[model samples]
Target: MLTATLCALLLVNLWTILRFREDKRRAVAGARRIPEADLLALALIGGTPGAFFARHRFRHKTRKQPFSTWLWLIAAIQAGALIGFGWPR
Candidate 1:
């Protein structure tokens, strides 16, 4: 169980990082953007850390109203849940 969880975390983080880099590329190339919902969904599913880092490192979506707010909110919730669920019995 722990192995699976850890694997998911790494994979999700990698995905988030790649997504951010791709988004930046498309933005500079004047191409279609990846959907915001897709990005948010990734964050909700254990990708929040990567998403947060990518946002700052790529300088994307930081100043966007409510988006940053939501990311932070999701991160906090995920952190709480992790603590709650992983608490020693």
Candidate 2:
């Protein structure tokens, strides 16, 4: 179970990072963009660490209002869950 979880996290992190890079490129070139929902879904699925880093690294979607709001909201929920349920006794 732990190994599977770690593998999922690693893959999602790489996926999120690539999405960030792609989205940034699209923004620069005026191409079709990845959806915000997709990015948020990636974060919610344990790729948040990567998403957080990508946000800063690419400077994409950092200052947006509701999107950033949702990202932080998801992060808060994840943290809360970890603390409340997953923390060691």
Candidate 3:
């Protein structure tokens, strides 16, 4: 079950990254602000890869803002959890 959940989460993260890429492209073309909230939702749902991808791909928010800091912190925690909990029995 955990494995399945992890797989699903990873897929979701990848999807989120793709979506973020689209949003960023649109932004460069003069679209409105990328819906970073969606990225936050993805991160909260164990999609740190998406968050990391967004940070680098879109250059979305690497500043000293609260949202950016919190997102990165959460992503780190999620990664640590996965590493700690994903080892073989």
CA lDDT of each prediction against the hidden true structure? 0.88, 0.93, 0.77
Against the hidden reference, what TM-scores do the models get?
0.88, 0.93, 0.69
lDDT of 1 by residue, 8-86 (tens): 9999998998998898889899999998878888999889989989988999988887877888899899878879899
Top-TM-score candidate index = 2
What is the TM-score of candidate 3?
A: 0.69
lDDT, candidate 2, 44-74, per-residue tens: 9988999999999999999988999999999
- After superposition, candidate 2 runs with Cα above 4 Å error: none
TM for candidate 2 is: 0.93
Tell me the deviation in Å of residue 86 in model 1: 4.4
| Least accurate 10 contiguous residues by lDDT in model 3 | 58-67
lDDT (Cα, 0-100) at 22 in candidate 3: 79
lDDT (tens digit, per residue) of candidate 3 on 15-83: 878877777778788977656677678888877777687768778666737778778788788768868
Pitting candidate 1 against candidate 2, the one with the higher lDDT is 2
> Would you give me the overall lDDT of model 3?
0.77
Candidate 2 residue-pair clash tally: 0
